[model samples]
Target: MPRTNLNDILIFMAVVDAGSFIAGGEALGLSRSAAGKAVIRLEDRLGARLLNRTTRTLSLTDEGRVFYDRGLQILASVDEAEASVAGQSGMPRGILRLTAPDAFGRLVILPLLEEYLRAWPDIQVEMSFTDRVADIVEEGFDLAIRIGATASDTRLVSRAIAAYRTRLCATPSYLAERGEPRDIADLAAHDCLIFASRTRRHGWRFRGKGSSWIKAQGRSRLRLDSGEAIRDAALAGLGIALLPDFLVADDLAAGRLRHVLPDLETDDAKIIMLYPDKHLLEPRIHRFVDLMVEALGRERPDARSSP
Candidate 1:
């Protein structure tokens, strides 16, 4: 059989990485039509549809996913070959695609990204910041920073980066008006702001008597999907909220919000990083992961209290 054109595979991978034919083609100094044709040619040769294209979005079919994974392996091999030469292995270059939780991305990851970018001038970054869980492999992300979550997919690798304490808090006025909860059971009478989405709902858990953890029974009248929104709601006196210390430390320190059950222990919000399982990661990915682990591997006291 005639050998498949390797250039077509490269174009296909670029399109998947860039999420659009136009951008992918630009990366390869080709026009959108050229890139689209190349992908079509690749699909034709494989006798399988690789991409599900629409006016606004592009997604991979199951066959496309398999092909894409193989393409990544091929690229990794190429990168490794180049790295074996002198000076190529040390300099990290290329786009690092990342997805992270919204508030944590803004408050935590952004600063780390600044440092990472400064350290490696050749590296470029693209970020998707949202509270919704992302399918890292399917969505074409190189890395994902998640809070209170772990990777369940066998195709991904999970690493713990940091842990932040969480607290139940309310505006002083809200607590004054609604009365502070004396115990976990008393929370049932107070309005609670909950973090919820179609995919997941965060429930508050506190240390119960004798080393047991009990779920809070607070009435959930207001449900928000964003951590910042929950913090804002608590500040607006809309309801009591359970939030990470990194998010609410300033409010608590400034007396804008009062901690409820301050003596009660809540589970630490574990910050984890997830990435595709690969034997040899690209240098850009390896460097950024190293920076994140170096910066956030230990619990920070400043994250728990106001600066």
Candidate 2:
């Protein structure tokens, strides 16, 4: 059988990645009609309907998904071949897809991403900032940054990037009104802001007088899914909150919130990076991971400083 045009496959993949024929064509400097025709030709050659298209959206059929995965492997091989020839001089070019927790993405990752973009002129990034844990492989994300989460999937590689101390805090008014919790048992009487989500609820745990740890028996009257929202609720004097230092350091330094039970020790909120477990990582993936490790492998002195 005659071979299918490789350019058609590239165009189809581009369209899927861009999520629209027009945008995909624009990426390759082709007209929408031309890109659409290329995809149709490829589909005809393969004798399969690849994409389910509507007026405003596009999604892959099962065959398209499989084909796309194979295409990714093919591209990886091509990239590896090019890198072998070019060695260290090879420039990283392609879209880097990333997902990170909402508040942390805005507060921390965005700055690093800005630097990454500056360092690599040919690279582009697509980001999803959400608290919801995403299936990195299924979602086609190159990397995911998570807080206090673990990867259970055997197909993913998880690396711990940083750890931040957590503090139980409340506004002065709330503390004054409710009285400060002198002991862990007192938490039962105070209103606590809990981090609850559809998948799981975050519970506060602290080291006891001995080596044992105990869960805080706080009365959770308000539950929020966002770390920043919990901080806001604490600032509003609604309740006491358990939050990472990075998110509430300024509030504590500015006297907006007071730390509760300063002597008590809490578990650190670990920052982890997750990606597919590929033997040979693309330059974009390895380079970004290296950047993250270099920047956040250890706690930076400025991480807790008030801005």
Candidate 3:
């Protein structure tokens, strides 16, 4: 077999990462035809197909997935080598892969990202925004922003970059129709919007009568995975929702949603940055994490400062 060209491999990786040939080509300064031909040449050299392509979508085949995973390992090694050589002058160049929850990523992370990009003009970022909990190591993410950090995973290290509180809130119209819930037990009588996922479920918890934390039991006739959707439901007079204050603060201020059970204190949500344990962390990842803590920890008003 002929020796594989590194440039061809890079082009293939770019195509896989960008999800389309045109966009991949755009990222690497290559024409669509040139990028397509480069991938074809790579596949021919390896005698294996990498991507499964259709008119509307593109996916990695089984072999492609394996190759992509190994490619990430190779890229990490390259990054590590580059970091060693560049030392203090690295300046956080190259693409930084990051993941965050959809609503928070958009509202909070994007603003910090704008500043990070402006300050570090040499660096590029690729972000995945979704509500699903991502497997950081398996997914090859350099950093992940998650709420409610317990740091159970031994393979990863987590740091609390910022904090936030959750609030039980409902629209005034809904409260008027259903009657206000004065205490924790009253929640059982009203419709509650739940945030649930395959692996996780959200329940309302507050500082109990005597200071111990207690979970509020409520009927979840309506449930949704997205935080923004849950807030919308509460705003539309569907039900009361327990949501992060950052999500509902504007609504509460605007009188679209009224805070419920203000006397009982709900648990604060910790905004955590999780990354795999590494002997030598890349400068890009280190700088980005610092940027998050600096920007979100101080600039974000919704971030829990005291608690």
Candidate 4:
């Protein structure tokens, strides 16, 4: 068998990552015909078909999946080797893979990405936004921005970027129609928007001056997976929603949504930066994480500051 070129492996990785030849070609700056031909050459050398192509979609064959899993490792090694040699110039280059929560990614990270892109034109980024927890090490991600507590992984490192807390809120119209709940027990009679079914069963918990408590029962009107959906429901006067305060801060300030049981505290979830545990942080990943922290510093509330 002929030795495979790095360019061919790169093309295969791009196709798997993008899940479309046309999109991969656009990303890699190759013509569709050229990209297809490169894959064909790669498969020819390997003596196995890598992709099952269709008019509308692309799928990885059994061998293709195996190659993809291994290909990422090969590419990562190449990237690291290049970075090591390129260290002489002291500038970070190559693509940085990152992940973040859906709504947070859309509202916060997307705005800041342009700055990173402009500051280091040579360094590219592939950002994935999803609510699902990602295995940074296994997925070959350089970094991940997560809310709530960071996951426990021996192969990963975590740093708190900012401290944030959740709040209970409802549209003024909703409150006007349903009246305010003065205490947790009052929630049993009111419509509350819940994020998880578990939250519905367990209820809300809070701690504050002169009180530490939990509310185990509420009349749930809607259960949503997205934070934005809960906030919107509250704004639309559908029900009271317990959501991250950062998400509804503008609404609270604009008088569209009113804070409920202000004296009774709610759960606090920290925003954190998670990355692979490494002996020496690659200059690119280090700089990217630092830039993200700085950007968060500017956007977070004064009350949410953490050392």
lDDT of 2 at 159: 79
Residue-wise C-alpha lDDT for candidate 1, range 174-246, written one tens digit per residue: 9888899888899999999998998788888888889998998889989999999999888999998888889
Off by over 4 Å in 4: 5-73, 82-90, 197-203, 209-216, 298-307
Q: Model 3 lDDT vs. the true structure?
A: 0.83
- In candidate 2, list every pair of residues with a backbone clash: none
Candidates' C-alpha lDDT: 0.85, 0.87, 0.83, 0.77
Worst 10 residues of 3 by lDDT: 298-307
Better candidate by TM-score, 2 or 3: 3
Between 1 and 2, whose TM-score is larger? 2
Q: For every model in order, what is the number of clashing pairs? A: 0, 0, 1, 0
What's the TM-score of every candidate structure?
A: 0.72, 0.74, 0.77, 0.71
Write the residue-wise lDDT of candidate 4 on 1-307 in tens digits. Answer: 5478879888887877788888888789998887888899999988899999888889999999999878765755666776676663457766788898788888888888888888887677889987666767777688888776543566777777776778889988888899999988888888988765322222567774477566537888687766787788888889988878679889999999899998877877678777776666666786787788887754342121111
| Model 3: per-residue Cα lDDT over 129-180, one tens digit each | 9888888889878888888744377677777767788888999999899999
The candidate, 1 or 3, that scores higher on lDDT is: 1
* Residue-level lDDT for 256 in candidate 2: 96
Best-to-worst TM-score order: 3, 2, 1, 4
Candidate closest to the true structure, highest lDDT = 2
- Residue 79's lDDT in candidate 4: 62
Candidate 2: Cα lDDT at 185 = 92
